[model samples]
Target: MHVPDGFINAPVSVAAGVVAAGAVAVSLRGARKELDERAAPLAGLVAAFIFAVQMLNFPVAAGTSGHLLGGALAAILVGPYTGVLVIAVVLLMQGILFADGGLTALGVNITVMGVVTVVVAYALFRGLVLILPRTRRSVTVASFVAALVSVPASAAAFTLVYAIGGTTQVPLGKVLTAMVGVHTLIGIGEAAITMLTVGAVIAVRPDLVYGARGLTAPLKLRVNGELVDAAPARDFTPVAARSPKKVWIGGLVAALVLAGFVSFYASASPDGLEKVAADKGFDKNVEEHAAAGSPLADYGVEGIEAARLSGGLAGVIGVGATLAVGTGAFWLVRRRRTESAGAQV
Candidate 1:
């Protein structure tokens, strides 16, 4: 959920900002090891896809809707550190370009939606994969469960943040209850989308899926009454020999279709956080977004009378901008890794 301005006091917001900054710094260092040639470009496409899917809000309850928080999906497809950066890129773009999330609340949104979700989802996903049967289906199952839990985890994080810095005097128990309850319903949708997307990727190119790596159980052969380790797959292709361009192009096209056209049919109901805020009486103090006057504010192009065309154009622009920024960041990280290696020579 995108926390608007005035929802949290200035001191707490600034404190959260510091925490967000530190997390990003740490993630950037970690991402250096994760963003190789194969993953660098896909990471950007993942960000754009997340940005697009988030626009297609699905109905969760009466007058309430939910969309992909995307931490689990991104972490499953890419590495966790890169997943955090990808989500941060989307949040930053939304705040500055579309006026969707407030600039002042950027830290809150990133902390809850990006950092907390990615950490919790990846941790749970790894744990489950280790215990369950090592198969592609198991990976998808783990992804579903991880995504299901991540949404409520994010809601709980928001509750904790609000308890410390909520502008209104809403009771903590009520806020926690409502937030968790609504988000739990939202989690179902999140799990479904994550399972399908991760499953699809695993089916096509399991090699590209970060979470699915090493998931295949080692082969066993019967050798003279004793079991022995079988040789590795002979058909396996080297990473350097494979091109990610096909997957990248397919993913980009899917994202364009989802945001440019399918988004028009998304539910109009307010999302889980907005609904809870209104129900809990904290919505009254919400301030206008600082970038509300931007041409692309609220995912619509300025001077475009047709709702469909304006929204489509805004969505396309958002996808392009997010892809550009995310790719640049990941490419820089990859370059730094190379330079560091060269210096060790």
Candidate 2:
């Protein structure tokens, strides 16, 4: 959930800001190992795709809706460190440009939605993949389960944070139950999206999926009635070299279609966090967004001829900006990695 300004007390938000800053710093170093020429561009596309999909909030309960958190999806598709950076980029763009998330709360959102989710999901994904049959199906299944669990884990993290620095007097018990219960439902949607996307990428370019690496297990060969493991597959190239150009093009087209054409049919209901906050009284502390007067405020272009067109244009702009910012950050990370390797040499 995109926590706007004032929901969390100023001190708590600042603390989260510090934590978020540290996370970014560490992620920059970690991502050097994860990103290369190939993953650099795909990382940008992943951020844009997350931005686009997040625009389509699906109904979870009668009054509340949930959208893709994208950390698990990004981490599984790319790498965990790069996934954190990608999501951070998307959050940065949404805060500064679309005013979706608050500027002050950027760190909170990134920490909860970006860092925590990636860590939890990636750990679970790796654990499951290690135990399960090393097949594409297993990878997809693990992705689904990892994504499903990560949402509730994030909810628990928020509750812990709120217990420490909640702005309101809401009971911790109520907050935990509501947050976990609603987010569990949201987790199912997250699982489906993560699984489907992972499956699609694995089907087309298994080489590019970070989680799918080394999945081409050596085939068993029967030689003179004795079965033996065949030679292991060669490590032709790292993940970044695998061109995701086709997947990227297809994703861009889908993003445009969803935000441009399909978004017209999306429900007008407030999302999960908004609904929960309103019903539970936590929304009272929400201050107005800084970009309240922006032309694309509220995801609608001011004075546009049609609501659909206005929203669509805003979505497109958001996607493009997110991609650019994400790509720039990732490219720099790659450059730093290259330079560091050279220095070591």
Candidate 2 lDDT (Cα, 0 to 1): 0.86
lDDT of 2 by residue, 224-266 (tens): 9999999877878665566677888998888777777777677
lDDT (Cα atoms) of all candidates against the true structure: 0.92, 0.86
Report the alpha-carbon TM-score of model 1 versus the true structure.
Answer: 0.95
Model 1: per-residue lDDT, tens digit, 1-345?
888998998999998899888889999999988887667779989999999999999998889999999999988898999988999999999999999887999999999999999999999999999999989999999999999999999999999999999999998899999999999999999999999999988777888899998776566899999998898878676854698888899999999999999998999999999999998899889999999999999999999999999999999999999999988888899899899989999
CA shift of 155, model 2, Å: 1.3
Per lDDT, the best of the predicted structures is 1
Worst 10 residues of 1 by lDDT: 232-241
Clashing residue pairs in candidate 2 are none
Alpha-carbon runs more than 4 Å astray in model 2: 217-242
TM-score of 2: 0.92
RMSD (CA, Å), candidate 2 to true, equals 3.0
Clash statistics: count for each candidate: 0, 0
Q: What's the residue-level lDDT of 243 in candidate 1? A: 88
